[model samples]
Target: MSPRRRRTEEFTSYYGRPILKEPTWEALDIAGYIFAGGLAGASSILAAGAQHTGRPRLERAAKLTAITAISASVAALVHDLGRPERFLNMLRVAKPTSPMSVGSWILSVYGPLAGASAAADVLGIFPRAGKAAGIGAGIAGSAVATYTAVLVSDTAVPTWHDAHAVMPFVFAGSAAASAGGIGAALSPLAEAGPARRMAIGGAAVETAMSFAMERSGRLSAETFHQGRAGTLLRLSKALTVGGAVGIALGGRSSRAVSAVGGLAVAAGSALLRFGIFEAGRASTLDPKYVVVPQRERLAARQEEPAKADTMG
Candidate 1:
């Protein structure tokens, strides 16, 4: 084939321009990794605050949860990479242009510290200074969670990119709530106050951000309110409310309540990721999402004569 024809045959953007594919189910799972790390980090912060306030149980709960969640987050990330060997390749050529590439480096740095801090606590090694590790790890973990929002938002996916302004807060809120629910399940009520409080705050933020995202763009919002995306939004709202109420009532004191509620928030967050990913794919599948806006822009441009032509 001629060079021009060869180049023409290659896949490109939705509109025959160069752009990445919409996120897949695998990508959704990777997004969950981000959600988990964020929750883990937020939990650590809450626990640290509890520790400073003389709440040993909350502190321990936070420390343990951050470690466990971060580990899970890393596991999901590796699982998404399709191979462990290729994971480090992310760092080999730090591409600021690619969000996933940057996120890989962030996770790599944060994952180990989170595991080590948790291990130190579990083994009682450096128990005296393990608190320091918890603080550090938790902060890094939070960054892991929130930064993914930026990663997804920076993409060309209409649903993901259009929701850029509110996506981070939504992810952060969901993460905080998930960790708090876990803490409530594992820690005593008195010490779990911080976690419970976080749950409420997170639920509110997630809900608000989601609403804002829907309002920000019609196409993006359609993904959430239609079909499976609608189902996720519905489930997320129900679970978020239930979890918040459970936390407020000090459900942590009850294992069943804690277990059920925590799982709800965690599941809800994962669903949100899937919903977002699917929506991006759906947006790409229909030319309306891609062409409508571009057509409007062209028509507007055509109506406006060039400066030189208009002046003549």
Candidate 2:
């Protein structure tokens, strides 16, 4: 065959079948679940910190938010499964290699502790027990905040797989910002100092890591700049940066400023999750993304044999 015909043939596939499996998740369900789960996890930590510091109002608000967010996260996960009963199957075995199984177990532990802590605080009963549960929930929350990153990064999606290292930090920071936003929104300005600071710090960390991921030069990075994902992520970055600035300027002295900043941060966190989900899906849909890297891998393997033969 002529060189031009060979090149053309290389680009074509039978029936134009996709080279990689598209993610079988709905944006509303999976993306929302990721945001809510992160929020719940970080809120548990905030609740524990508030309890330790004797901030009753902040503690109560954080605890309630943790429980509520986790519950909603579970609902979203189940909804994404199409059949709610399939969620139970995940609980049947604990597989270390499977991020979903591990995440399910983490959620199970976190949900009960969060619920009990919130309930005990609300009922004004067993303060010591509630504090202990809050601490446990906080530890579990860390897993929840970061595990979803592992879940996505473990997949075949080029962007997500290449982003394994930074994605966890991004998600964790976003979670902290989201939790802080919720706490700040619920507390008085004077009591919201820590939450505001957390929100700002988290936003800074999240923004830096996200920028790093986008500029890493991986083929998958194209997904972040091309379409709906790009639009949403750009908006997320603007809102996050703007909210952090707002908090830095007036969060401590003005309730209105704190509330607006908090809302912006929370909304940005949600958008980040949705944008990431969309980007991963877009990466899988393009055959070039799946083919080029694999072709390079094969070429590298072929070179290894020739190099060894030459050395011998």
Best by lDDT: 2
**Residue 6 lDDT (model 1):** 49
Q: What is the lDDT of residue 162 in candidate 1?
A: 75
lDDT of 1 by residue, 72-103 (tens): 77778778878877887777888877778877
lDDT of each: 0.71, 0.89
TM-score per model over all chains: 0.82, 0.93
Candidate 2's residue-wise lDDT over 1-312, tens digit each?
864335434765557787888988899899999999999999999988988887889889999999999999999999988887798889999999899899999998999999999999999899889889999999999998889999999988888998998999999989999999888889987677778888999899889999998887776787887799999999999999899899889888888889899889989999999999999999887776777667767989999999999999
Query: What lDDT, from 0 to 1, does candidate 1 have?
Result: 0.71
Backbone Cα, N, C clashes tallied per candidate = 2, 0
